[model samples]
Target chain A: MYGESKSGMQCAEFDLLMTDAIDGLLTGDQLSRFEQHKTACPTCSAMFAEAEAGLHWLGQLEEVDPPVNLARNIVLATSGLANEGARASLRSVVNTTPGRPLWDRMRDAFSPRTIWDHVRGTARAIFSPMATPRFAMSAGMAFFSLSMVFTVSGVKISDLRNLDLTPRNLTRTYYATEARAVKYYENIRLVYEIESRVRELRRAASTSSVEPEQENKQKNKQDQKSPKENEQRQYQNFSRQDSASVVIATFDPGESVIGESARQRRKL
Target chain B: MEDAQVVELLVRRCIAGDAAAWEEIVQRFNRRIYNICYRFAGSPTDAEDLTQDVFIKVYRTMASYDGERASFNTWITTVTRNLLVDHFRKTKNDRITDSIDAAPGESEDALPLSDRLEDTGPAPDAHLERRETRELVQAALQKLSPELREAVILRDLQDMDYKEIAQALRVPEGTVKSRINRGRAELARLLQRTYRQVM
Candidate 1:
């Protein structure tokens, strides 16, 4: 691919020089050198001929018309993009435009009524005393008065010397005397004895009633032939006992004794 | 309108966001820009797309235009050349192929020489021969490298002088002349080959 070189122009340089020669751009010394090289070099000569022929041929090509819609399409596309930009810009302008008057802004800054109201509110908040302590004192007084009324209504003072004394009455009188005296003393001994006796009686009653109630429930269950029926019978017995206990607790002593005798007869 | 006046008005309206003026600008240069793009892309469709792209680029960068440096035509041509070179680099997979055809709307009697003759008309055979010669020239022009192609298109097709071509291409005048010469020689060889093939 090497060609004749002249005046420091190699093959590639020679080609460039030959192009320059064809284009009539080479200067005095370069022009003479290029001409000498072309005269001696067949490749440079051919290249020059080819370059001329090519330029001549290029001069002949017809300039074709583009598509008819080309300009219209471009305009449409660019217009669409531009219109969108314009709309965005317009929106920004509208958003940024001042909506309020200068007087309105000034009035808002220095309104006298609002300043006075704020000052009044601050003064009230700083100086005003809370009513919670006074309300609490009133409530305490009402509570103390209610308690005094209840205590005075519930208490009665009888003559202390009228308590009775015969052998059976002496035993009752002694118990009454002991009961009155017991209120004055610590009386741990009597209270302990009463508690122990009540506990013993409760244990005995529970032990005696549990077996009978269970036996009755079992018998009722056997008669009914179902556990649910036995449970219902047990619940009925418990309800009867609960009602009787309530009646006994609510009755006067004389009525209670009579009711107990009647209950004992019924049991018998 | 005078070219300078039209350019000035269009530039003013374009800056003012006048779409109609922008469209007139596009219409005015569409053919010329398309021709430049066609010379680079060697396909009408690609050329059309590239021309549209060039105008879009021009519109975007118009704000940066400093009128002191270059004429509008030279600026646009430079934009087109740079865009085409970028397109060539991006789409290296598809080679550009040029096919010769008659200019659109140009009849047989409307050949360049015939038009120059001032006879108002010419014989059909002369026009056809002129068209054939034009096609041969175009086929030859397609054989050049991008730089040489740019030089030839600017010099011969666009009918710009070496100085203008050099200014458009940002090259020395001597370099532009050398490129044109090399490009023309390559184009001649291509034309001969094509002629031989046709024969």
Candidate 2:
């Protein structure tokens, strides 16, 4: 009903009122207003019709005959839950009920003990060396956090291999400024790498010049078909011999086995 | 015995740890709860699982039930609806990936309650149209947002009056009314789009 009335209602409001009217929810003044509005407005009339049709369509949706075994399956699945509840009230009249079950009392007697045992077992296993899932998760998280802390401290995990971890060195490391120690380690490591490279190059030069006869003998013993392949093999042998350095930093007792991959990268 | 009296007796027995009484309670509400779960889940397997879980939860929380607060039906509806809301939340991502055409298996059991209700009465083309409309309506119902869909299901499909819906949803009567109105309009639009071709 689009008629200009003394009390002007918005189109949305009228539409909503029409919905209520269709449901027979609008009574008295509300119903009176909606009837007047819909007669005047074709849109409102359509709205009422649409609402009515929708409700009709929905109403046509009937109570489906439930699946045949649904109740049985539910009863089976929820029996344990029901028993849990039953256990709480078992001291009361349920104990007198016919067909009183055994599992309920068994569960009541042992469940807390079992649950407590599990909790205690979990607590004991968490920090132990034998890896449980929860323990592994914690260990992994600890490793990640420690790695992040080491990275932020400018002490890469690889750097621990180079630091001398003796009592005297440990004290120096403990007392040293973090930035100063890191800078010193970086420069000294660079110098060590250069010296190692120089030593390898000198060894290569001496071998080629001084051991020409020996090189020839080796070449004769090995395959001499490809000059390119021979050269590549010589370079690879030199690299493998010098790649990994055992810097052996004792900053952390746990990192004793790790070699300096940083120094290894410069070997090529 | 009236449903209320039966419910009261069952609740008392269930609380008293009477397993038989609990089974009887499950028998009473299983069908009603399954239908509600089916409306929300859109698949029989999921509906059955949800229904089982819902009853389990109801049994666990049976001790807290206060008849003064709400009738057993209203209280149980609230519990079922809350569980559905939580389930929808958990499965929202997975549900988004599913195609609209990937409708669940439409076994006789999976069909809308209306289809089954009218099966005995309708004849020929009327039966076919009703079946078709029922399927379309169900699909459309699934398309609505959870709030709107629940409101429509409770108010229109389940024939719950506004007061019951408000009590079940824990919303004000006015909010329930508006949600029903919006849901109906959306459902109508969906049906109109679908029926434009068939009708």
Candidate 3:
């Protein structure tokens, strides 16, 4: 009880109202009583004045701005605790499951509640940033595109489950791959042969047409030669042409034999 | 929603293991807590460390919070105060009680605290630079006992009301007021005796 004494406002009463007086909260009768007490008592008056000055100095002591990393450090520290707490809680839950038959416990392990909790936790941990609707939609579209590719590639999920990895099957697969590669190489070689033959025929026709006089001279020389020698010369010329075609096919299969022949004819 | 309701929801979210909610709580209160620590510990580095320790304690014990009993602000202030008191107890023996006659920088030729001050009471119009006043006040505040120091800090510097300060200190309202009165008187005396001109 801080009632006024017979002495009229003791030091205790003055101390009681000091804060309110300094804050200007005292008014009317209380204000009058406080002012009278302050004037009547030197100790109370000095204490009151000093308190006001103390408040003034405190007002000057501005709030010290925290370091810039304070909030970040706090968050990092607490978030680590939160994660540990979550893990601890999970362990507690798992540990507290009532003892039961292994089979029953196993069944309960797959229970919807347990599964849902695990799924929710995993989602929070792994996909928290991807929880947006836009991200979900993008994820769904990507899954659908992957499914389409699998279907087009004839890759059934069942087929994946039943894949044949036996040695015999592996051997068959290896031979099949080898056969396919050989067939591809043969096709390329056939194309090269056809192109080279066409170029040779075109060159032969062009040479005869462009230099008939030279061809006639060659024919006369052939006529003058013995038949056996002429046959030997023809065989030698055929062998040289065959060797050139083989060299072109081996060294640069993609080079155009027709372009080469045209350049050769121009030089001749 | 009102601010009280918003804070209540945040508390619920934090209890539900929402890290972002906890982060928001830290963002809202870190500066206040740091300032309280700064006033009590008398150094920024110590204040920073104590602020972190306070939050860590709060985080671990958040489940014990009862909203119906007190606001988050009061509870956090209580946590910060408790941590500061604990730290003081730990480092109490290490603190050097400098003699009043000791010179600045401990040099013999330098002026003592009492000799360096201007011989005048603080004028209503007397204006010390903000930084100078802050340094003078902080020095005076550090001279008070922990009990009195905390009272004035929460009351005047922190702007907490009597009820909030009482709750944070776990003391009666009357005791809070009495300590605040004594604390302020002592602080004023310290400042007036030493840095009288800067008041």
DockQ of each: 0.26, 0.41, 0.33
Candidate 1 chain B lowest-lDDT run of ten? B100-109
Better of 1 and 2 by lDDT: 2
lDDT of each: 0.69, 0.72, 0.79
Largest DockQ belongs to which candidate?
Answer: 2
lDDT, candidate 2, B1-199, per-residue tens: 9889789888887776678898888888888888888887777788888988899889777776766678888889999999999999999988742333335334534544333334555455877667666666777788889999898888776777788889999998778877887787777876787555333
Question: Who is ahead in lDDT, 2 or 3?
Answer: 3
What ranges in model 3 sit over 4 Å off? A1-7, A84-268, B99-128, B196-199
The C-alpha TM-scores of every prediction are 0.48, 0.56, 0.57
Global CA lDDT computed for model 1: 0.69
Residue lDDT tens for model 3, B8-107:
8887777766778888888888999999998898877888999999999988777767777899899999999999999999999987646443322212
What is candidate 2's local distance difference test score? 0.72
Weakest 10 consecutive residues of candidate 3 chain A by summed lDDT: A87-96
- Better model by TM-score, 1 or 2? 2
Sorted by DockQ, highest first, which candidate order results? Answer: 2, 3, 1
Per-residue lDDT value at A138 in model 1: 83
Top of the candidates by lDDT: 3
